[model samples]
Target: MRASRFFALRERGTDARTEALGGLATFLTMSYIVFVNPAILSSAGLPFDAVAVATALAAGGFTIIMGLTTNLPFALASGLGINAVVAFDIILGRKVSPDVGMACIVLEGLLAVVLVLAGMREAVVRAVPTSLKLAIGVGIGLFIALVGLRDGGIVVNDPSTGIALGDLSTGPALIALAGILVALGCAAANVRGAILIGIATSTVLGLVFGVLDGPSAVARWPTSGDFSTIGDGLAPGALRDALTWALVPIIFSLFMTDFFDTVGTAYAVTSAGGLLDERGEIPKVRNLLLVDSAAAAGGGAMGVSSVTTYVESGAGVAEGARTGLASVVTGLLFALTIFFVPLIAVVGQGVTVGKDTTLHPAIAPALVMVGYLMIQLVREIEWDRPEDAVPAFLTIAGIPLTFSISAGIGLGVFGYVVTMIARGRVREIHPIMWMLVPMFVAFFASNWLSAHVF
Candidate 1:
């Protein structure tokens, strides 16, 4: 068959029907991004509808690219952690415009590709401790949960203490809590599409409680206006602005997150499918990395955030998918969602909770569920060893507390280097890890330097 010949289905031992089923499964598992992404980006002043459009477009287009180029089942989308960095750290915290924030992602993506081509990843990958890499994902998971809580109106800024529990009595908070419970129930039942299911349930409850407005239309054809945010990162001066000295560490942090996440996701997903080669490495992994890296830049260029391969692709692989055909099916599903942006906006649209706080009661459940899922990485760290324990603790705590992924990473690096020296392992530290110490210092003090020196 043409399909079998094109995707090597026969060699991979997966039929076209099986591949289709796998792709459908994958799409169902990770499709929650269509609603959640716009809700997060809109917090940084981007339009909700436009960002929703961009998210679907970038996810669909790049996922297809991944399938075509690498012949892998990995799916791509706006990454959750990287989106937080763009929305909260760079855009809001550093006072840079949204376009400039995305420009940083574009640069990070391009740099990642260059590093891959130059074969310079060995030293950089080996330099960081395994515990730290694991902790970054765990910390970002906590950070995402915190954002979910705030968005759900389950947590609020306290004048006396930094944060306090919100009034669970409110409609939005109650709806969010209900949604979270539903998600947990679904997960416990081993249901596929638990996150998306939770979001749908929450939206229904929000509508019932009058906490969310209904959509004006169910579906509509996308227009040029719907894609207005495309290429915003490449606007004149945006790239140049992202090249400043102050943003050096920020970009580096983004690159690290993008790079490490792909490495981990690729390994785990491929391993699950029994696809690793004799050396215990993924086949054509370089192509996988290349497509993943380009997706990051493509996402930024499309005015979303950095896109990366999703572990959710494992859903497809588990269902007998062994080639890119499954990815093509998943990508097509994502593209079809663009027409339903109006329905999606109903969930993305938030409720006004206070004078200034807008609560996204419908979308909060998915974010909370995703955070819970990511936090599972915490168990992999060897907690008894102080050298690893301290840095991992700092990283896991710093991200949500400081509300800065990069700052949390900086703290972890500092703790790692300090602990290594104190443990008499000074000479064992990789030169690259040592180099990161001063860079993180500059990152931590960039604001001060900008005000006084630079």
Candidate 2:
């Protein structure tokens, strides 16, 4: 009896060890996005450091909520779409006050809350066809891969020259790219902590090449001196005019992007993890939606413009994590990094000339992934049935070209509807799809009206 007890105890210990390792792996996988996202957003004049800290906390809280409510392993954060809107459109283009932006964020969160309580979340997911979900997953993968490639210097911007080779012959940039590529290759080959390894290697190479020298490299943690006025710079009343005009577009972009991004990520990660049940559905999806909504709401309170689920979390999900334990671990690690924001910001600035410079390494990876996914999509679609393939093909290609994911999706949906009508399959299409026609008309008409009216 004592011998049997000893064996049981040992088994329990082994299980615990396994759980711990799984959690740690998840945290490591997500850390890259968590760290880099804020830095990128901040370069556009938003309070990146504070937003980073808040996002981490919000993510942790939401993760805990999901675990308690649904028992499904998932985490949340400011989404890529929101980050782009905040960086490019709101901060730079419209010059809206960050305070007003935060207010809009809060409203979006409230809308998400309503969405969850109304059971719309699950209903929409259920309503979406599998083919669209697949396209979304592939699209997100391509999007993120493009982001990585651009940051890594594999792609560059030139209006006159168009797409061409970047300055890869340089020391630091070349070293960083090589290091990241080597690390990614290792990860693909089953090496653990691939991203961290890549970052460290690049950092070292950066130092050796004198790219990360001077005061920029030596700045202390939680660097708040330069941003002392951030908290006090609220021009809420002054922002109303701008906010009024921009609100519709901002909200529309945020909702469309976040909704699809979350859906696509959930589908992709669940598929990769082999977590889909016999019915090809994720279990306890309601709880995941709730967690996501709550995180967005929390992000608004913390002054970040938009918070949503991360599609890149698929990287962790692909690595064998099966429980919310992974999310919890990731959240905790992000919380700890709050103290090092200054150091990170400083280091980030030192290595990359500006925020755009930091984006060089990510560009190549993005292109490669997009190319790969497009190939896969072409193979999967029923090309002989041009009615189906043409629409899907357009959706896949239109996103990057149009510079708007929603517009791309909108075009795809419109194409699908037109094709269905042409093929005499109109009855098979959902009634909600009819809504697309008017939306398309309205969207383009508004653009035309704006050009002429203004």
Candidate 3:
């Protein structure tokens, strides 16, 4: 089959332009990782440029693999939470070396690949309630919006008020507001590439208004030798020292977090893309899972943290991404960052705003709009049933509040099990639920586990 026929672009009513635009939307929303991953990892003695280069390759390469093999419009990259855990809790806090952290990532990733090849993921998907699955999708949408608002200076953290409206009087805030209006209007008009066009408009407006300055270099190559320090560069016996019984909980926690986090993201984004089967389960799931494991292993080899799926891919799905072509477009865009650093910086980089002049601009509108689109999934929940409504609400409400996808999933599972058993529906629980509930309990008690076991 020709690649286009295999992707069913004509059958699904999507053309190359739509797929390209969807991919661009997904890339723009998630590209912040290129800047963020390096900044967080460099604190633990890694080189900034080296981490930056690795981040781009990890995201682009593995995401392209996802696009080609599974044809789902999902992207994978070094995860946000796991990076901090590796940097702060493992390396810096425990006095473990960075090289050992990479080793741990490789081991953890190997476990994930093993699970996939062994065909053990089916029950894990079946364990999640349908209402909660939709909630997961909706929750990720809201989470992406919240992140964009905070990043764009449209919403600021207020110690007294929790989250207050940012000073819209500033330039970046104004740009965000303008971008939101323009993007919304374009979407309403059923325009192609509305999200990408909105972002481009905002960047051009920023430059014209002196809000965002251009980068010094137009097109520069990465000048770092970071790839030289990958999985094999352990600190003599550091890998062994880091792998004692005490490290079990820590590694387990990493595995649990990486495992479920990817599950939630993959479920949420694919659902938004209308890729779920009749039972709300992903088709060819085992094959899809391989890309995630490959991404994590590749990230480890590149000296980064555990790689996982980004919920921001929901932004593209909301904009009408229905196939892997979107993922290919997204990956190619990320790869271009290596040479087009300056161009990406102008849009993806933060624009100075607010009193301290520290906020990113130009991308918040697309996020908020996509979030609005995801909210419709809430209606799909079987709200008439208390068992469904309660857990679904917990998941939808808790995701943005907790700032963690896995946290919301845990709470929803807890709510569902409690409600089901309380309602005398104990027999309704899947066997996998018993396994998941205890794992969730362990995840919630992770800090205590660390203090006692580790």
Off by over 4 Å in 3: 1-52, 71-108, 225-258, 261-281, 303-306, 309-330, 350-358, 366-370
Lowest-scoring 10 consecutive residues by lDDT in candidate 3?
226-235
lDDT of each residue in 1-454, candidate 1, tens digit only:
8878989998998899999999999898888888989988898998888899899989998998899888889899999878978987789889999999999999999998887777666446546787887787788778878888888989999999989999999999998889889998998898877888888888998888788888899999988888988998988799999999888778888987788777756766787798988976678877887788888888888889999988789889988899999999999999999999899999988787668787788888888887887787788789999888999999899988988777887899899989999999999888888888888887788779777776
Please state the error at residue 179 of candidate 3 in Å.
Answer: 2.8
Q: Residue 75's C-alpha lDDT in candidate 1?
A: 94
Cα lDDT tens digits, model 3, 79-152, are 86677668767788778778787767777777788877877655666666767767876776787678667757
lDDT measured at residue 120 in model 3 versus the true structure, 0 to 100 = 66
Question: Best by TM-score, which number?
Answer: 1
lDDT (CA) per prediction: 0.86, 0.59, 0.75
Q: Which scores greater on lDDT, model 1 or model 3?
A: 1
Clashes of each: 0, 24, 0
Clash list (residue pairs), candidate 1: none
Better of 1 and 3 by TM-score: 1
For model 3, what is the C-alpha lDDT against the true structure? 0.75
